[model samples]
Target chain A: MKIVLCVKQVPDTSDIKWTENNTIQREGLESIINPYDVYAFESALRLKNKYKNVNISALTMGPKQAEGMLRKLIAIGVDDAVLLSDKKFAGADTFATAKTIAAAIKSKLSDFDLIVCGQFAIDGDTAQTGPSIANFLDIPQVTYVKEVVGYEDGYLTVIRELDSGFEKVRVKLPALICVLQGEFEPVRARINGIIHSQQVEIPVYGIDDIGLSVEDAGLKGSPTYVNKAYRAPQKETECVFVESCEELAECIKKCGGICE
Target chain B: MSKGILVYSEITSDDYLHTVVFELANKAVELSKKMEDAPVMALVLTKPDLINEYKEAFQKSGFDKVFYVVDERFGTYRTDLFAKAAVQAVKQIDPEIMLVGATCQGRDLAPRISTALGTGLTADCTGLDILENGKFAATRPTFGGQLMATILCKKYPQMASVRPKVFKPSEVDVTRDTVFIKMSVDLDDYVPQIEVLEFTKKLVCDLNDLDSAKIIVAGGKGMKNAEGFALLKKLADKLGGCVGASRVAVEMGLAPQAVQIGQTGKTVSPKLYIACGISGALQHTIGMNSAEKIIAINTDKNAPIFDICDYGIVGDAFEIIPKLLEL
Candidate 1:
């Protein structure tokens, strides 16, 4: 079984700072593989360990800097890595992003039996890219997947987390599954694995490599755009302190106006 | 000329609309009033029989028109099926704005629908308003709740998903009336390739339902370790309240994610919110800020939690919690 995992490099939200103009300041802040995508990579490695013929590949789309994220994936135990990087791909929304990924997948259609992704990228939190790519590819896609059951010849069974409960879903092979964060423990990076990853060369594909035109893969393809962003004015409220339990009780009673 | 607002009515298994749906309906009514009798549209995607169960409720909740998409395949919540039906409905109605509850289903469905319709979506919004030109202005916390950003959608029918309990539901008027419109959708048109075999509800601790609890005891990073949360649990039991944690607590593996109350966590509104050793980051305050009264018990008097707290005590929660429990 061959599996392809899509990973994204997002600014480490922990160290994120804002510009005076309200735009995210990514300069100097480190970027890491999206925390959720780590779960996807781990899940793929787990499957590889379970099946002898299993092969895993990591796929990502962003600037050339994103290739570094793929190296981390290979170090954790992926067979290969592919980066679809192009300057024209900048400012692509979830739709265009999914289209670009779909194009890459189509370019390598015969190499994989399944595609996996993090449930959502923390930066965007849209959670739409995976399903949109699935829609674009016209394949079955499941989001918020927490557990994966055994796979049959042509079908895969998995459990999805819902608002109220969990649902068991079965989809045919060559489908997409987006794993949620903390769904599985991530694999530890081994020194030998890191050494091997340093030797593994990542294949970078551009718009032409994926057989997609610039008009169809980047900002031009994105329909949504941010018009303006401004800081919201804070609402004013008065705070009262109570030093003792009796004072607290009295304050509560006064606030309620003694119940008429 | 008036505008129409579409609300994706989130439904529970017990057949009642979720709290957030009603809140959005109430907000829609407020927005509609401002827009000169703009119709508040309720979009219900459910089984045909389930439509009747919600008709009166929608009417009372101030929906001017209820669009019901009755299909057997939509009996369950599937992202693709629901989003496709909703996008089609929006296209047919051409509402000026759409609102959905920021629950798991709404978070999943709204983004997809926005993508399908090629529109912008603001998620996890805390507030909504209409601009002079009738554009939807959605406000949500950004920069991890350090700042709030109000976004405007240049596209028509601006979409937003408001957090649950962010807006209060209005009093239901049983005598209120509405126009019902039925939409026919072909289930086979967009078949869900994935089949749901069964649903298993995780047994989350019932003691963590902080929103409805009269009293809530919450801990933060200052709680030290997992054992600190155990102490919070004991205090919660004594107070007959539920236990909640900040995002830090959940990230530290001190508590389950469900019980976490913060910007990225559950938004809880309780009568009394007791902060134990909580420094009160902005992200944490967004969840419990709506509480009727807040009491902060932290050793650091400079903790941001003290700024918004109704009562602040400059003492150790570990030492004070035990004394309070004995009292």
Candidate 2:
């Protein structure tokens, strides 16, 4: 079975800082694999460890620096890696990003059975790219997946997380699943895996290499554009400070806290 | 060009109209006014028996018209099935603007619909409005709530999935003759791509249900232990609300990860959010700052929580909460 893991490199949102003028200052922030994508990779690796002849390929679309992150995935457990690197792919919204990714998969990894992606990226946090990719490929997609319960006979059972609860569904291959971040322990890269990564050839695909025109690869392909960007307003509350809990409880009551 | 404003009225697993539908309806009314009173409409896909449940909501919420498609397979949500039906509805109606609630299910469905239509969709929008040129503008938080961007879509169906509760529902029911139109779509040739085997609803009144809670009492690393959380839980119970946690508190196991409220977790807009022992980082505060009222209790007088709270107490949550719970 062949699985493609769609991963992204994002700024570590936790380490992002703010300037004195209330603007985001990301100059010194480090870029790392999106935290949710790690969970997705873990899910894929679990299948490989449990089953036989399961190969996982890591794919990403970003600047050439993204090749480093893909190599890291190789050391962890990925069978191979593909970097869809091109200046034309930068700044594309989910629409264009999905087009570029689906194009690469069709042109390069066309025979793949499944694609797994993190439910969201910390930088975009759109949670749209995964499903959009599935749409562009004309395949089924399941989002907010918590677990891959079981897989047999070309079918995989997944537990999807909902706003209210969880639903387990059995979906066939040629599908895409976006997984939520779950509580997972770190998976260390084996020494042998590290040695192999050093010798492995990471293939790079450009806009033309993926059968995409420059117009269909980047901002030109994107339908949405940022009109204005600013700091979110901090609504002034004129917060009244109180010394005692009695006043706090009184205020809570006035705010309609208690209800039948 | 598109003519009307359309909202995807989602029916949840509980077999009821998701509250976000009414919330979107309320916002849609305003946007319609801005669009020279463009008609406000709704689209629903559900089983035949469950079809009528949303009518009163549509009427009272001031929806001008409703278009629905029913099939037995709609008993539960299947992305393949729903998206197919919704895409058909969009083609049939050809609305100028489409709004979807950014709940887990809506987020799962919106992109597929937008991509199928070859249009743009702005995700998790906190604000929606019309520009001077009449293009739809969606304002949303980007880079994990660190920066806000006003986005514009240059395609048809100016689609956006709005964050729930950002716009409040109407206070009074509006009496409108909402026209109901039943649209026909044949799925006999359609085959199910996925089979739902089991479902487990989260426990009712779960402390993690911050989205619908009227009030929430959340804690942070200052909530040092189970004992601190126990105090928070007590206050939450006293207020008939729920308990939420900062990512640090969840990491420390003071609260379950399900209840973690931050940039990476659930965004809530409860009526009152009592932030105890929390120093409001932008990541944490952005999730709850939309609450109508917020009160914070911490030992540090200059905690950032005070910057966004409606009330502040520069003292211990331990001492303050116990007394508040006693009331």
State each model's TM-score restricted to chain B.
Answer: 0.94, 0.92
Candidate 2 lDDT, tens digit per residue, B1-327?
667899999998878899899999999998888889899999999899877777887899989999999988887888999998899888889999999998888999999999999899998888889887888999988776778999998888989998776788999877589999999875656778888999998988553677778889899989899999988887888788899999778867687656778766778889899898898987788789888899899999988889888888899887777677666
**Candidate 1 interface RMSD, angstroms, 1 decimal:** 4.4
TM-score each candidate: 0.88, 0.94
Candidate 2 structure quality by residue, lDDT tens digits, A1-260: 89999999999776778888777787888899998899899999988988999999999998788888988898989999999998888879999999999999999999998999999898878899999999999999989898888789998899987767788999988899998866667799999889878889999999889889977878999989989888777767788998777787778878888622
Residue B218's lDDT in candidate 2: 92
Interface RMSD of each: 4.4, 2.3
Q: How close to the true structure is residue A167 of candidate 2, measured as C-alpha lDDT? A: 89
Enumerate residue pairs that collide in model 2: none
User: How many residue pairs clash per model?
Assistant: 0, 0
> What is the lDDT of every predicted structure here?
0.77, 0.87
TM-score of chain A of 1: 0.89
User: What are the candidates' individual DockQ scores?
Assistant: 0.35, 0.67
Error of 1 at B83 (Å): 3.8
